[model samples]
Target: MSKPLEITNLYKRFGGLIAVNDVSFKLQPGEVVGLLGPNGSGKTTVLNMISGALPCDGGSVRIGSTDITKMKPHRVAKNGVARTFQLVRPLPTLSVAENVQLSLAFGKKRHWGREARTLAEEKLAFVGLEGRGDERVGNLTYIDQKRMEMARALASEPELLLLDEWLAGLNPSELRIGIDLVKNLQGQGMTVLLVEHIMEAVRALCSRCVVMSAGEKIAEGPSAEVLREPAVIKAYLGDDHA
Candidate 1:
């Protein structure tokens, strides 16, 4: 099978700031890959390029067999890519079910009516938000709100899911739950590209991880081994981690 995503010579710049610099990688079908970096290492910029939230200044963003480098963000979603952002901005006025319904309406139409309802319900359940779909999403707890965002993404019936800090602001237990949710999604054959600062969560979920610094990849390989590489340690972890 072909890879779920391939990014080659990717670059993005914000005026004088070089956010993502010539980054490149491939994510295989059914794989969970981690993108690790500090605050300005351009991890999210890479996501923006790959997800079409921001256009890349150079290189290509290919999902499966199609090159979607210059496609609009909405078109990118229609092309089998869905993403959850770090902020988890739920529609304050919309019920959880309605939020997910909007995602379904915008998807590739793999299901509808009862079938769509069933799929949406299943997604909420997968994120551990079962039976709460009727509630206004703004009323949920912070973690639950993030789960709502996740449920919305899953409702897209996506082949690839881009997760930005999927476990960032949670408590220890919430982090565990989030990790389990991601693992369950992976088990269902959804390819995942996770961008996160949580080392433990990344190590736990990612089969392979790519680390970056100053907008370029510094090290990449098996999660545990890569995080421990001397160069990776020095570049990312610095003296304390060493």
Candidate 2:
């Protein structure tokens, strides 16, 4: 079942720099929401906190009714939250399938042996990587590596998927494929929170948007309207655009 994500008063600091400040938003079950911001806007920091890769200085993160504010990364994954990092990280020593198996072993639903292998391959195929499960992670192309990372995330069968710029750096054709892949996930009722700079993809995929600038939320609403807001425009294209 898809789960809702609620973040309230989320904050983070690095010494004197406040990376995030009292940010809050809610994602209803199966809704795809865009997190937009320019470089250093703390969008990635927010994802890190939500995935337990970074500790929150102050705030609350919840999946459905369970609090996950302080959970470890693995524990957060076990609670139906799965994410793809901005930088793809695959186990270099392992085969593509094995990398995905790690997620299956530790994800919300635990699988083992042939079951895990079978499920992992199924996910790979779902991401358009059929029959290449035995290949080394290093052997795949950049886009293929991204596909593998996504397959690994999906192996967890997560209720909420966090995608951090997964659509960036794709060629036009590849971008279309990426967009379709996200659409497929949305169609399958997976709630998604994506941080993307590609305005086209953001406009195509998200029903709603929450935009941040300088660690503070500047706009939130329907994707089209939010993208047109003065504050959001200023954050992305500077004062001239606004």
Q: Which candidate is the best by TM-score?
A: 2
Clashes of each: 0, 0
**Candidate 1 overall lDDT versus native:** 0.87
Pick by lDDT: which candidate is best? 2
Find the 10 residues in a row with the least total lDDT in model 1.
Answer: 108-117
Q: How high a TM-score does candidate 2 get?
A: 0.98
Per-model lDDT: 0.87, 0.94
- Per-residue lDDT tens digits for candidate 2, residues 1-242, read 78789999999999999999999999999999999999999999999999999999999999999999999999999999999988999999999999999999999889999999999999999999999999999999888898999999999989999999998788998899899999999999999999999989998999999999999988899999998888887888889889
Cand. 1 TM to true fold: 0.94
Predicted candidate 1 versus true structure: per-residue lDDT over 1-242, tens digit per residue: 22479999999889998888899999999999999877788888998888888999999999878999999888888888999998887888988987887789887565667767777788898888899888997689989998989999988878889999978899999998889989898888889999988888987889999988999998889999988888777776577776
TM-scores, in order shown?
0.94, 0.98
Q: List the residue pairs that clash in candidate 1.
A: none
Q: Give candidate 1 regions above 4 Å deviation.
A: 1-3, 110-118, 239-242
